[model samples]
Target: MAAPATATILSDEEKAVFAELRNEHEKHRSVMIKMDRYYEGVQRLEHIGLAVPPELRRFETVVNLPRIAVDEVERRLDVKSLMLPDDQIANEDLRVGWEYNDLDAQAPQAHKEAMIFGRSFVTVGSNEEDPDQPLMTVESPRHMSVKIDNRRRQMTAALRQYIDPERKTDSATLYLPNTTIWLTRDNGSRWNVTDRDDHNIGRVPVVMFLNRQRTGSWFGTSEMHDVLPLTDAIARSLTNLQIAAETHSVPQKYVLGMTKGDFVDKNGDPIPVWESYFSGIWAHANKDAKVGQFSPSDLKNFHDTVNHYMALAAAITGLPVRYMGQQTVNPAAEGAIRADEARLVKNTERKQVSFGASWGWSMSLRERFRTGEFPRNGRIRLEWYDAGTPTMAQRSDSIQKLSGGTPILSREGAWDELGWSEARKARERQYFLAQESDPYFQRIQEKEELNDPSILRDPVQEPDHA
Candidate 1:
């Protein structure tokens, strides 16, 4: 059953607070939306408009470098598990909630949005139907905004807005530390409090996932902002190249003394310019007419210019040239490829650290929603897969060497390094324990050990006692 909507009204101060937060949210909404358009390959051709004729505007093309830049980093991030030291139950509880939320699929989406729009949000609340599993949702910055308390380094307030075109209503949920105010407006009506919830969590449930945040800034900087101009340039160059191919791919022909009337078909109707140009045969009664051709324009320069901007974009975004569709005569060696990815891998690790914190905070809120109190004993730590590109064989070899003869790494540590999920690790542990306890298997192992010539040669020796 759904929880009944409370009829609590908002006070004047609460209304003003919501208004302020909503206004702040409005200020960033447009910018975030524009970035989203760029990331989606739907941004209007800004530089191509002047060069491209209006009729050829349909030939405009987008290189989609923003998506490439953001996705390249986003794909490297994957959360393995959330850890609570010495608290297996708490860890398992968080894992259950994490899976219940389908964060494996949702997290990458949030990361991409954060990369494109500077930041994204994750909201946690109670699931009335399943009390054990809290409801967690990934929210885009387009419809959400947050205010952080710099000293505390926490979100003090957040506002999430919604629009219902079918119903012609606008709704918003203002999340405060002590109370949540739900406001609604019908058509052009004034905002009215429709519902409220006072959970008194003492902290806003919304957690912001920042991307490339500066030292002193609360919000993050969009990853696409730096390469947007290059993307435009590439798009413009490609559009111009297409237009040139259409208009000048064939050599131009001129008739010095022939008029339009002279270019006529057998029926005496004037031939269209395109038909006459492509017909390959021409005849005129005027003996003074002279025909000549201009060589077709070489499009190599346009292609080279596009490649130039692509290289600049790759450099600025830490992406390999090949990622931008630049092909080389010789393929890059394995070591060289890894070296090229060093900067991108390091950047991905930084994002994992930053975004991991927000995910951990959101899970903590999930725990609070589940138990009505936060876990005070151990801290929540999110475990992420290694952001580098190492083959499975390489990872296995490294794990074996690290775990072989020294106490440098443990079994669990090896499993973590292998990026195995907790469930798989647990299952493997169960199988190992079961095999060790099997009597038949132990008897067969003992028979083989007794038959071994080395064991016979090194027969057991009893210790001497006084």
Candidate 2:
């Protein structure tokens, strides 16, 4: 636990490496920004300002399907705890670090960001104030990037940048396996090394979580990518529906052979045509002028079009129709609801598999930071809550059947399957062992054993035995 060596200067080679990694990070900025806009429901509004007329732009609406699509999948993924094969409960050392970092709240944020932007990062470092609890943080892709060695399948370097608006400067941290460099620059100044730390941990402390990554790809695919276009379409449809309601919800009227002067107000100024039409009063001195009305536009087409795109989005993203705001007259039965969510549940499980590995790696890094040694013996695993939506009765029945009078599943394993936290399971275990050791309970058990017919018959003398 000696403090890492710190310096205020970087070598020429290190400077070049930092520059390259920063440039690589810059390459993903635009894509992440666009994804952010979509996730925040602002991407379509940007287009509306250009496509919609100034007066009608206010009526433009956003359906926010991207957020819904991402959230539907994100809500199903919940990492409960970390465990090793031989442990009855979660790893206490890792749990300390996890709670120290408030990961119960932050982990979901990281997961959602990974889903939105294809990847997110976790950085692990030693906490100088408390050696036993390491510092862990979840980083958004918007500000971080990593360089991976394809052959080794490891991150060789990582860069995290931040803009200090209050100071009117920008700063970045470049992470290497053995060194960490901090650089800063003013609005127009060159990059200067503020400080550098040589920790020599032997591996990059950044853990990258990829969402739905394909083979041979360095970056994962964003969950919002497929739904973005459909989301835009839905927004446009809703905006148009809003515009139609504003302009044509009421019957539009036409006047033949009428002069502009006929629509003048009491102030002798010409009243706007729209104002006169909506005012519901038409007066003219010309007797020959004629008036006729056109029927209001049918808005059902817009609703149908929006619903069509929503259905397509639901189908493409494996989201249920109800999640897309489509409702049925009859409430679906529990079985039907579960069936509709099968694909989504499966997809969530896949994400859990992917993110779970990164989390385990991060916690392992935390252990290294704390104990100065890597976890090498048992397999480290992250325990995730069941992604499927099963009723309590159903879950209980299933667990009972699996653990009842059989060695197929251990008692601890049954508790794990029941979604009990490590703390709760530990408490229950204590109570169970206490009950087994109780004198009254032991006496009752002995009495029951003595009165059993099998025990009474076992004492019978054997006829032919020696």
Shift of residue 396 alpha carbon in model 2, Å: 3.9
Relative to the true structure, candidate 1 reaches a TM of: 0.86
lDDT of 2: 0.81
Backbone clash count for every predicted candidate, in the order shown:
0, 0
Task: For candidate 2, write residues 95-146 as lDDT tens digits.
Answer: 7678889998999999999999999999987666887888889999999988
Task: State the C-alpha lDDT per candidate.
Answer: 0.80, 0.81
**Model 1 regions more than 4 Å off:** 1-8, 46-52, 85-90, 164-168, 257-275, 280-289, 329-333, 377-379, 394-414, 430-454, 457-466
Candidate 1: RMSD over Cα atoms? 4.7
Off by over 4 Å in 2: 1-6, 44-50, 85-88, 164-168, 186-188, 254-292, 329-331, 395-414, 427-466
Q: What is the lDDT of candidate 1?
A: 0.80
lDDT of 1 by residue, 1-466 (tens): 1244565456777777777888998887778768878888987775335455578878988889888889999899998888764554227777778888998899998998899888899988766688788789999989987777888777888889998566568988888886767778856657777766666788887888888889878778998889988888888788888889988987878778877777888888888877888772366667888888888999999988988998898899988787887866434454565787889999999998899888877877888878888767644788788787765665556666888845666788777767899889999999989999999999999999989877545224745574
Clashing pairs for model 1 are none
Q: Which candidate is the best by lDDT?
A: 2
Instruction: State how far residue 407 of model 1 sits from its true place (Å).
Output: 11
